[model samples]
Target chain A: MTTTAVDILGADDVSRAITRISHEIVERNPALDSVVIVGMQTGGTWIAKRLCESVNKIVEGANVPLGAIDISLYRDDYSLRPVVLSAPTDIPVDLTGRTVVLVDDVLFTGRTVRAALEALNDYGRPRAVQLAVMVDRGHRELPIRPDYVGKNIPTHFSDEVAVGPNGVTVSAVAT
Target chain B: MKHLLDTHDLSIDDIVNILDVADRMAEVNRRQVPKVPALKGKTIATVFFEDSTRTRLSFETAARRLSADVLTFLASSSSVNKGESLRDTIETLSAMGVQAFVVRHKSSGVPLQLSQWTDASVINAGDGWHQHPTQGLLDAYTITREFGTPTSLAGRTVAIVGDIKHSRVARSNIDLFTRLGARVVLVAPPSLLPSHVETWPVDVRSTMDDVIDNVDVVYLLRMQLERMQSASIPNLAEYTRLYALTPERAAVLQDHALLMHPGPMNRGVEITVDPADVAGSRILQQVTNGVSIRMAVLFTLLGGDSVSSLTAGGEA
Candidate 1:
């Protein structure tokens, strides 16, 4: 099988996606004070920072609490994959009675989001939990959907999608 | 990677990784609800052949916080009193689908021996005077936290004081501290020193006065009354005079120097000053860090996909 790499989204597209998602978040949730943004560790950390920055610009004086969670402990695939821990989970405030906006880099198997949901319960019960991702590549093993999506790029199961500050690239099998 | 038998099996990278995970576990422990579903379906059986207060409770608490089911097997209450063989007892627990075993025995290498009889991951809580790897890791973690960096102990010097011959804490820390690039100086009487001390990687000092002010950390070891079959020291008063962390010696310590004790401390024998009064004492922190370090060990052994691939029959 021959693999071909193609740039699915450019750097400008990535920036615009954040701006659009930030607007969508502000439009859907009127009470910005009750909203908190949490990024998944490693991959989602940078995107979450950017999302928080974009949301802050959309509404002046919107100080969203940015946090990060490492779901290595809460994963369902410890038996299937090597479970390596990442950065520490830092939830700055009591998450009870607050709407949590969970941000991630990519949405594929949805297993990581499942683990993230379980991890959130340990902090405090949130009023509502919403997921935001940079890329939704369409192979979800769980019944999880991203509320705010950057780009819905449908691809094969074997194809790989890499998200970065530069752009989103997909490596697919050549026809 | 599979079982935590001793510090010898842990490389500097493995030690650093465990400490890093321990930092995360520390975060979880600080939460309002200090629990995670990491090991919900998994069970950890703490099979202690000897008596304990903190080590057993610490391991159990670590497992419980991680949402792992804990089965406590006390040697006194169990069928072992009815002459059940070690193999039979282990087989019994292994039949119950235990994924991990935290074994503490009065004899050295019992956990290593037990790992052979079962496929479960074995953690050596304390085995005679051989090693206590988690304690080593926790002590290292405590120092790392004090210094404000994970690899900050690289240039620092640590002095291990009292009962070097029969102290598993000293044995383990000597390996762990030196591996993390800290110079360890062992302070004890000639009789209390191990027989083959020359082969070990450390500096030897006879009294605390020799290296009192120069060290970065002073780690006190408990004088195990039970382990002392023969009188290694002349008397408690003489031992205290010669080696105990008295007020004068404590005053001689640098302001930046930290005091650490693996607890249930022998106040008059090893540490004479009140730990509470000392500004640099980390005794209580050692107890607190033990939970996080054990959680790291338990999660590393049971929650990973690597252990399932490795044959448990090989040496740990």
Candidate 2:
């Protein structure tokens, strides 16, 4: 069963969005000495590393600590499916009192952000946590909202977004 | 993440999911380019404050297979000799961009504490005697692979014989086996049985011979001399005579019944039956499964998905 793919954001658009987000982050928190970019696993993680690179280029002497977090074990549905052996969560920097920018590809239900928060809490409490997403498809089930949104894409509950190193595409199927 | 905190964080389905992923990882182990670019630019810091070679090496192999660099920190050469706390070492490593932290500490909740202090993933290797989630998962996988179904443990009686009080393996096995539908019998001397055994969902037996003929599997646990602070038993020999799985006693079991052990076996102390001739011995299988199981765990926790799925009402 094949489905049609709709171009939501291209690679150039993503790079521009990330560049703008980096500026916004520095503007929002002028005292930010070092930024720790934690990707929300899978695609979000790749985006986070790229965003960190962009942010480093913009700010002098500002090197962002990067890490990838997996929240599979913390999922509420953990009991529903078989146990999934997850990859190693790699956060190569200390999170103690540092400004944490959680990056993701798409923010749909806000649950991923919530899980990232829970997973981050286990690591350490950050000075402040800012959420950065390439696409913020609004359908929040919780009170949580992103601190810096790249592009707010509105859609029905059934639609989904697939983001990779190539670009961001939207689909009707639930991914 | 470095530390494997607790088995309580894992559900029955979580255990099964990891086992399934491990099956796939096993295939990866056979390939020529066994290494994947999954954790290419990453590093896994394994800090074992306790004594363990099998679990440590298994974790190392799993990380290496994923192409993640490994930095092993044993207590011997570490600043731990200078009384540097685990927290200090973790913070130092965190500064160096150590991505994931696999920690095995003697304290029950040390991994959880470290998890709270670092940004890295905390994979509890084995904490105190509280839980060995990976060991439990691998054992479950071994059983499933042998039986041809994940839930084949159902209706089977698994008798866990030996140091139940001090064995993290036994504790994890009880949870996993029971979840897989096996009726678990924890056979050990009263002194070796934890006071909290009554709280667990398992039948307790003081004698191994009583349950020998009925069980489908005999699981022996090691008896650490460190645990016997004041000689809980009359002597090691007497203890072996009373509770060990002797060759003659093993012969009483059904021919199809298996024998298993989470090794670093204590030979004559825990089991009088030689490990070499134990017909159903899957101890080696458990070790082999450890790498694959760990690979599945690392990939699932870090690889293909978002952290969102872990939360309530997370994005699909």
Best by TM-score: 1
Tell me the spans in candidate 2 whose CA falls farther than 4 Å from its real position.
A1-175, B1-4, B305-316
Model 2, span B1-316: residue lDDT tens: 2334666667666777777778767755654445544555678888999878889999999999877799999998889999998889999999989878888988888888898999888888888878888888888888888877765588788899988888888888888888788999988889888887889999998887789989888888888866667677768887888788898887887877778888888888887788678777888888888998998877666564344444332244
Off by over 4 Å in 1: B226-229, B307-316
- TM-score per model over all chains: 0.95, 0.63
The sequence of per-residue lDDT tens digits that candidate 1 reaches over residues B104-219 is: 99999999999999999999999998999999999999999899879647899999998889889899999989888899999999998999899998999998999998999999
Question: How well docked is model 1, in DockQ terms?
Answer: 0.46
Q: What is the C-alpha lDDT of each candidate?
A: 0.89, 0.78
**Predicted complexes: DockQ each:** 0.46, 0.04
Task: Give interface RMSD, per candidate.
Answer: 9.7, 10.6
Model 1 pairs in collision: none
